[model samples]
Target: MAGGVLGVGIGIVAAAAAAAAGVGAERLVRARQTAIDLGVEDDFVDIPDHEAAVISDAVPLHVEIDDPSPGSPTRQPTVVLSHGYTQHHGVWHYQRKALRDAGFRVVLWDHRGHGQSEIGDPASYTIEQLGRDLHEVIGQIVPKGPLILIGHSMGGMAIMALAEQFPEVVSERVVGAGFICTSSGALSTVDFGLGKQIGAAVHRLGPGTVSRLSTRQKLVDTALRAGRDVEDFLVHRYSFGSDVPMAVVRYTADMIFQTPMSVISAFMPTLLAHERTDGLAAFDGIETLVMHGQQDRIVPRKHADDMVARMPHSEYIVVEASGHMLPLEHPEIVNTEVVALAERSCRAVDSGKRRARGVPRNVTDLRAGGRSRRTTKRAAAK
Candidate 1:
C-alpha cells in the first residue's frame, strides 16, 4: 500500500509539472498574439536610433549628465549609473553630486517604462530589451573609451546580461563595473526577499491581459492605498540601516510606486531566472567591485560575497549599517569608492599601461578606522 501511495504521489507531481508547462506555453502564445495586435515585435529587436535620438519605445528612457561642461576634462572617465527595479535614475541624486565633485563625468538614465522614459506599449518592455538599450547607450556615450558601469538591483542584473549577451561591447569598452545589492544567479532563492515573491508571481502571469490590468491607474491606486502601511513597513525594513532622510526614502518610494506593474510582470521573471554566473568571465581581465549591505534584507550580503569569490580580484564591500539601498543609504561611502576606482582605472588607461592592481578595497573597511590604521602603520615604518 505504501509503495502504491508513493507511486500515486509521483504521478500527481508529474501531472502538475505537465500542466504548468502547458499553461506557460499558452501564455507565451497569447502574449505573442497580443504583441502582434499591438504592432510590436514579440522577440527582442534592436530599436533603431530615431532622428532626435530620443529614447522611444512602448517604454521611454531618459538620460542625464551632471557635468556636460566641455573642455573641463575631456579625458576623464565616465561612470554610467543604472538604478534597480521599480526605481528611476533620480535615486542616485546624492551620489551624482559627489561624483561630479570628484572630477569625473557621470551618466545616469532611467530605464524604459520608468521615470521620464516613455511608456508606450508595456508589451515591448523586457530584460533583453533593456540590455540592448544599455548597449546602445554605451555605443553613443562611451564609444571607444573605457567606462565604469554601476548598477543597482535589477540594473545590475541588466548590466550582467548585457555583458553576457554582448561580449564584444563589454570587452572593448567596459573597464570597471560595480554591482550594488544585486544577485548574479538564482534570484528566486528567497535570499532576495521581495524579489523572490514578486518574481514568482510575474513568471506565472507571463505578461498578457493580467500584466496590463495590473498597470492600470485605478488598480495601482487602490493597491497602493491598501498597501500603504505595508509600504512604510518595507521601507523601514529594506531601504536603510539607520534613520535615513525622509526625502531620500520618499523619493525612492515614489519611484517604486510610479513603476507600473506591467513593467514588473514583464521583467521580474527574467531577472530571477537569469543565470549570469559565467558572465563575470568577460571581466576577468578587468576591474570589478561588488558592494552590498551586510544588513541588507532584500538582496542578502552573501550574494555580494559570492560575487567577490567568483571575481576574486574584484573589490568586495559589506556596508555594516546599510540595507539594500546602499547608493542612497550610504551615498558618501559609495561615492568615495566609486570615484577612487574611476581615478585608478582612468590613470591606468591614460598611462597606456595597466598597473599591478592593489588589494581589493571595501567601503566599510575604509570607514571603520581602517584608513587611520594604515596611516599610523606607514608613519611607524618610516
Candidate 2:
C-alpha cells in the first residue's frame, strides 16, 4: 500500500510537469499567432516611442509613451493606463492598441517595484504613493493635454488616490476615467474564493506572513515553479470569467507567476488596509465608468455596486460571467466603453472651449455671425 501511494504521488507530479511544459509551448505559439493577427510587426513597430524616468516619492518610475497615429492632430487627448498589483504595463497591450488606433496618445508605466521601475522604499508602498507617482507621470509626460485615465484593480485604487490627493488636476485636465475590477474599501473582509474563515485568517495574518514567506525567496520561487499547474488553476479561477481563451489565461498567469514575492509582500499590507470611499467625491461631475466582473472572486461585485452608489452619475457596467480580469476577458467591451468615454469627453471639452472663447451656443447664431463677417469684409473691399 505504501509503495502504491508513493507511485501515485510521483505520477501526479510528473503529469503536472508535463502539462505545464505543454501549456508553455502552446502559449508561445498562440502569442506568435496573435502578434501576426494584430499586425504588431507593422502597426506597432513604428509608433514613436518615448521613455521617461519620473521621480515620485524618491522612486524613479519607468514610463513609456506611444505617440498618436500619423497625422493625428497635435494636442489630442491622451489616455493614461495603469495596471493592477503584480502587473506591469504590458498587461494593457490590448487597450493600448485600441486607444492608439483611435488616434489617442497612450501612456503606460510600471508602478514602483512592479516592473522595470526601481523599488524605492518598501515602506512607501502605499496606494497614496502610487497616486503621487501617477500625478508626477502626468505632469512630466503629458503636460498641457486633455486626459482620459484608465485603471484596473490596484490601479483603480491609485486613480482614486489621485482624485483625492490632486483634485485640482482631476478637474483641470481629466475629462473621463475608467475604474475596472477594483474596490474602494473593506477589501480585507471580502471572500477571495477562499472559505470565509480562511479568507479572514489570511486577512488577519497576510502582511506579516507574506513578509516572512518572502524571506525564503528562492525556496518559494522553486515551490511556485514546481506547482505551475496549481498556479494556473488558481489564476484562472480568480482572475477570469467564462470561456476565456487559453492563450489569454496563460499570458495572465505568466505575468502573475513572474511577479517577485517581495512585491506581493510589500503591497499586501497596503491592499488590506486600503479604504478610499471618500475619494469618490473627487470624481463628482466628472465622466466616470465603473466596471466589474459578476464572478470576480478577488474583488466582488458588491464593491462595484457600492462605488456606483457613491457616484450615481457614473456609468456602471457589470460583465456577466466574468472574473476579476475584465480587461483581458472582455477587451472588446472594455475598449468600446473607453472609446465612448473619450468621445464624450472630447465633445464636452470642445463645448467648454467654445464657451470659454465667447462663441454663441446656438448653431444658427454662429452661422449668422460667420455670414455677417464675410459680408462686412466684402462691403469694406467695395
What's the lDDT of the predicted structure labeled candidate 2?
A: 0.68
Model 1 segments more than 4 A misplaced: 1-60, 68-75, 120-123, 191-216, 223-227, 355-382
Whole-structure CA lDDT of model 1: 0.61
Query: Which candidate wins on lDDT?
Result: 2
lDDT of 2 by residue, 216-316 (tens): 77976787678655555445555765555556656776666566657767777677788999888787767778877777777878897788778776767
lDDT of 2 at 205: 53
Deviation of model 2 at 6, angstroms? 35
Model 2 alpha-carbon miss at residue 147, Å: 1.5
Worst 10 residues of 1 by lDDT: 1-10
> Lowest summed lDDT over 10 consecutive residues: which window, candidate 2?
1-10
Compute the lDDT of residue 329 as modeled in candidate 2.
Answer: 73
